[model samples]
Target: MTLSAQTKVGPAGLISDLQSLGLRLEDNEVGVTGRRGGAGPSDHKAVSLAGRTVMIPIATVSACESPFVASRPDANGISEIRRNGVVVSHIEFPRQPRFYDLQTTEGIPYSQIATLHSSDVLATTLLQSCIRYGNRNTSCQFCAIGQSLSAGKTILRKTPEQLAEVAKAAVELDNVKHMVMTTGTPNLTDRGAALLCESAEAVKAVVDLPIQGQCEPPDDDIWFERMKAAGIASLGMHLEAITPEVRARIMPGKAGVVLERYMDAFDAAVAVFGRGQVSTYILAGLGDTPDVILSVSEQLITKGVYPFVVPFVPITGTPLENHPAPTPAFMAQILPQLGAMLKKANLLSHDMKAGCAKCGACSALASYEV
Candidate 1:
């Protein structure tokens, strides 16, 4: 059923639609600058709607054919969002960060080291290369982690000093609230913990912003303590797909680690990061039924871990580029139930110190929490 101009949709519904179907810009002026083809919420632009910012997909194939469209921004930097030629809402795009103009003393651009995520979060991939990404049999089918590296949009490795430099400038210039550092799986041993710790420590040395470090479970649980001591305020270990079959089918090599290992790791990391501070990302449109997603989410909440469920976006240049994203109706079924559960557990996205769940831009789950 197509929505007509008379249909009434709230902020949560609008966010869900924009994320799933994406927004087609009627004019190029609306999105003069935005992220494209990189790690951590690629091909998205931060759109401020209903007093909160969201990372809406704008570069996907689905966006080109979406029912939602945005007109050029007025002098006040606000644009009108229309559905079937009916004005539904007005939105604002975050201006390009001030830090993007500066470079390290060595001449490496700060934008190349760390980019602004959501509206105020500074995000960077410590290592652009991933072990699984190099092999088709092992890589996550939905990943485009290598595209930015290949396109020269980002550097392969960001040194601790360089990260600290960019992080400080972002805080001072852009008023960046926190930092999110995610790395591709470097190896099976530390699983990128060592680099995250080093980067966090360096960033903390020069800035006071909170930091979230995301990676696979490290072989030794002691790394959690090391990370906390290094000034990491929160942690994220993503379970992009919940079911074993889907995990194996979508990310075969990652599946080898097994769900048991992830559970154990989550318990240990939660012990270090504290309740509500340790979180996991669950992608909703990746063949997991609502029951399966809710069941896993309940388990995570029981263990005091926040389960952030987001719609699956088919990034271009990846194996699943042609895969269809979840419909707004599909997300509607899950988000409300999950939001109620989080309320019952006293877990809220706003209370989070830093990270994707805290940013709450890639998913509309945050809006439902209210």
Candidate 2:
């Protein structure tokens, strides 16, 4: 069922609102298995409506159950999104990727190496185990990286050859456009930069896919040039929370890196990868006000960095799992401001060679792009 773009509320606003509130998945048999790399436990599933595809959170502790969203198989595969018994819109879920089925010659499951993200991006946590994950004093309060590994969903480490093979197959089978490779911080200084370089080289040898390598800032700034030379078209150095209070309270282990160090790394990365290609994830509602978040975003934009501010999603099993997600109004207040700033800087997500902001599925800020 096609929806009329002109609704009581604008279509983009509706998407931003739904993503903020989170959709209630009722009897939806088709969905992706929840991954443990990031802040949230809610499954990253593709939701299509209003001529666009957005990845929304579902089947988590924080998901809303009141305004139920169900896929009616009996109704010709249409998804009805309801608000108090009235159908507001019909949505569709994307089918699972083909690459999940095949394995490498050595019997490693392809999915263990990497998984499909949104519709066209392949993302993987290159090293599933983080040095800070087990140490409570050091761990990021919102991280669940070790949870998936404990459940046997992914391998401990992916070899460069294995990652290369998986990348090639995902591209050939699903027509994947870009790939994102993120890793748990191996050590305070290692930060997976060396591993990412090897992985990118192997993947590029077999296929010509644009790749983004995400890691904490490395000790040496020269790693940025090495990453770019190794076929990493984009780089993501995420500061999940901005303020020092929030950082020290939430991600104690990572906070030791200091905010100033990350800014320096951003400048070096932008110089190597160019402006829009360097991005960071500043998660809102992690003890920062809308104004506070916007202020940091402004500073980041001035340094030729793309501040991809995302709303915080509480994941089950993490310390902050019970923490409240940011309200729709707060998101509504901040996203447009950030989007406008991005527009003024001419740092469009569309111009990003490859990365999360370019994918624009996890956050609704892209919906507000002018």
Candidate 3:
């Protein structure tokens, strides 16, 4: 028997393959569309590639429909394009965590605080609320943090003990491998980094999984060292956009964090976490040109930071929900250049040791480029 073709392909090819799998991609101002249940014109669903389900609005899909996709989209945009009724390059959807079945002693849902990502990684918004989430003048246009919270799916503040309990259960029952603690910016001296450390320490005391913490650069560079000491194996200080104008328009609140400050934090994190352990997320197709992304990625690689570039897929209820994902052709065009930068700097995703992009689940850029 011959194995199904595993050659890498681009976005257009990915969509075509998915269409052949009985999945349809309906172009909408709200991104790609598909159908899950008994089909009809009104049955088309809006969905996210994150976990690959026909995530129709709550009003559309029956509550009985699986909330998560049985198979997810590959980094190149291919779905289950099977041959001879056998799956190829199958992408597994994250299994819902057992922790979701429990609640904090305070009666808060565990899922509300920190939920599982990629089946084995625990991710949470320590503070579900961001100062930016409410202010159109300040919020990252693409963020749905507040929308999810308002929908009663998550909590605003998660206690350290609560995080510890969930972490313990997730690791023991679900085979969780790592933890990611992120937060909305609080009007405090340490920004959200200090709270992340407290949560990291709490989770560390009970579980031994590698931990990654994401936050803006704090006012003090010393906080990076503090985080490393707190059992965090790696750090993510995201510079979501590369250009000043885009920064201001996309994330007014985060844009206040000067580029120099981020560079400083990246340098500090590298010193503490070692090369390849420090990373930043660069979202392509957010009105940024390939030239700009390549230039910024080159600089990040030179500084010993892994630049994890991903296509910007706008989520529903966010300001950019209507925005289209970057064409796969665009991603393919730039990934080679960005990947070369990684090779030159010796910053490979496998070298990240542990983290989101390192897992190579979100973007196929790593699998293809590396």
Using TM-score, give the best candidate's number.
1
lDDT of 2: 0.81
Choose 2 or 3, whichever is better by TM-score. 2
Q: lDDT per residue, candidate 2, 141-207, as tens digits?
A: 9888887777777888999989888999999999999999999888777589998999999999999
The Cα local distance difference test for each model comes to: 0.90, 0.81, 0.66
lDDT for predicted candidate 3 compared with the true structure: 0.66
Candidate 1: 10-residue stretch with minimal lDDT: 1-10
Q: Model 1: per-residue lDDT, tens digit, 1-370?
A: 1122223767788888889999889987644555777778977888888778888888888888899898998898788888889899888877888999999888888888999988899999999989999898999998888898888888999999999889888989999998899999999999999999999999999889899999998999999999999999999999999899999999998888888999999999999999999999999899999999999999999999999999999898898888999999999889989999999999998889999999999998988887
lDDT of 1: 0.90
- Candidate 1 deviant stretches above 4 angstroms: 1-7, 29-31
Model 3 Cα lDDT, one tens digit per residue, 148-184? 6666777778888999998888888788778778888
Candidate 1 clash pair list: none
Q: Which residue pairs overlap in candidate 3's backbone?
A: none
Instruction: Point out the higher-scoring one by lDDT: 1 or 2.
Output: 1
Model 3 residue 164 lDDT score? 91
- TM-scores for every predicted model: 0.97, 0.94, 0.79
